[model samples]
Target: MNRTLEIELIDELIALKSARGLFLEEDIGHAPVERYASDDQFDTELELVFRRRPHLAAHVSELAKPGDFLRVDLAGRPVLVTRGKDGVARAFLNVCRHRGAQLVGENAGCQNRFTCPYHAWTYASSGELISAPHFASGFPDADKTQFGLTAMPTYEALGFVWVVPSPDSSLGAPFDFKNYFAPIAAEVSELDLADHVQVANDRISVAANWKIIVEGGIEAYHFKIAHRDTIAPFFEDNLSSFRSLGAHMRSIIPRVSLARLGDSPRDGWRLRDHANTLYSLFPTAQFLVQQDHVVLIVANPLAADHTELRIATLVPKSEAGDSELWMRNHAITRTTLDEDFALGESIQRGLTSGANAKLTFGRFEGALTAFNQSVADTIAAVS
Candidate 1:
């Protein structure tokens, strides 16, 4: 983060401390229960919202060498992302051109070529078809070039790989990361995310809608109640601030220790020293920024009542040593997330019980409203 922005967010924190207040909206917000329990709504989200958004497929470090590859599910599409011998990252539909067989069964590995189990059709890491089992005898008139894997829109920057899973024409044609992020580009650049290496990886499945889990991350209102024995004591009482980044969000949740800074002459102050900054990379992911490391989380909604999160702990190269420390941190992070997600699951069940028509968001928890509004707006725009 820029020092100026750090100072600004801190000063806001200091003010909230003095006033014993939190960020508030002009009015409370209500979201219909249907948003979570309705099958049609979930289908629309998968088709409209997820398919059209950029997914953080993998951190570049995961593909440290040329020809490294990983298979990921983006939206509902099976995607194969590869770091080619030419040192460029690319994405393709993880389907065999010959028979639509699901190719690349492994989750991740270092391979320069892939062979279909069904027909033995081979493809290079660059997604070019290399050969067929019997080119001379079978379909000799077919063009091998036309049988190559279908390319998805792919962009690599700031040490991360981004791919739009859909074939939307607007995201194609060179597929640049839209300039929508231009405003916060400098702020994100200062984090030097590329300088980090992932130290841990885990997946957790929760019986809750994906948005419910996302909403939990952007608010501190439930910290004391939901994470009482875990992360609650360390943070303030419902105290945090947030700002919109295009359709995304950035939240600053301050710690109790921040109060100790106490009007002291400040110089070279850092936000991470006293708070956790959370970034919602809209539609699918969040980057929980801590002083020593970052936690990359991607939520994949499996159904109206189920979601799976892929969590990776990233540590700066300077702190990548001390594997035990990162392991402990990852464990603690998982514990806290489990606490939040347990409650999320409970909320989903409540929504199905027909107790309330809509859920309420207090004026202070404005980010939830903004997020839901963004979803509604996106789906509405094309409706």
Candidate 2:
């Protein structure tokens, strides 16, 4: 967020701390239990929500130099993003044109050319076909120019790579980065992610719906109780703030130390020192902003009740020498998120028992309703 707006929010948090109040919505809201337990709904989300929108594939820092490349699965389609010799970022289908074999199997690496393991078809980082092993008399009539990797719509903005994932015209065609990311673009720019690099990371599978995992970050109603052993002591009990950013949501969870800032000068106060800021980046990603590093959490839904969670801690390149601090940040995030996701697993297991017709969101937990509603709206817009 911009410094002016961040300072404004910090001031609000300070005042709320003094009054012992909570930032809430106009009224309470609720979501249905089936939203997290139904097969049909899960399929609809994969098709309508994930496929039809741009996905946060990787940070620009991940592909910072020429020949840098990374492979990712967005909505089940394997994609390869590369920083070519021209210093431009491009994305492809990650499939060799000669055969259906994957172009890159490793998650990330730096290579100017990729060779197909099946047919030895070589391709440049620019997606151009360089050579084939059996071009002499094997396929005399073949046009090698037609066998380059298929390109997808890709944009590099806000220090991240955004891809449509699908080359089809059915959805996400004519990708519009400006409008799609407009709501939070300025805020993200203020974060200067381009100047940061990933220092620590973890990946795990959680037995819960992706939505269940996301809802955990947007509310603090469970922080004190669910995280009593980890982060609860540092944060105020049931006191947090949130606001909608188009399809995204931003929540600021103030620490207990913030109460000491009452009537103090804001010039010396840093938001990250007094609170943890979480950004719900639309579909299946989150940014956990902390004091000296940012933790990115991306969820890949394997099923209605299973998700692959990847966490990466990014610190400013200037501070990359502080390996201990970055590692500590990653560990704390991993521990706290593990607690929240485990609770989500328990909720998912009980969601099918027909215990409640609808799960209610308290006034302070209103962002959950907003997020679910956005999911429903996106899915419904297709038909």
Highest lDDT, which number?
Answer: 1
Instruction: List residue ranges in candidate 2 displaced over 4 A.
Output: 133-143, 168-172
lDDT of each: 0.87, 0.86
| lDDT by residue (tens digit), candidate 1, 219-321 | 9999998899999899999999999888788999999888767666669566898999998887887889997889988998889999989899999999899
Clashing pairs in 1: none
Q: Worst 10-residue stretch by lDDT in candidate 1?
A: 167-176
Candidate 2 C-alpha lDDT tens digits along 1-383 = 66788788888987777777888788999888888989898888888888777788889888989999999888888999999999989889999988689989999999999999998999999999999987868879999888889887788987788887777444444767789778977877877988898898678999999999999888889988999999899989888888888888888999988878765887877788899888887888788888877889998887899998889998899999978877877888888889999899999989988788878999989888889888987788755
Instruction: Give the per-residue Cα lDDT of candidate 1 at 369.
Output: 97
Candidate of highest TM-score: 1
Off by over 4 Å in 1: 168-175
Question: Model 1 Cα displacement at 48 (Å)?
Answer: 1.0
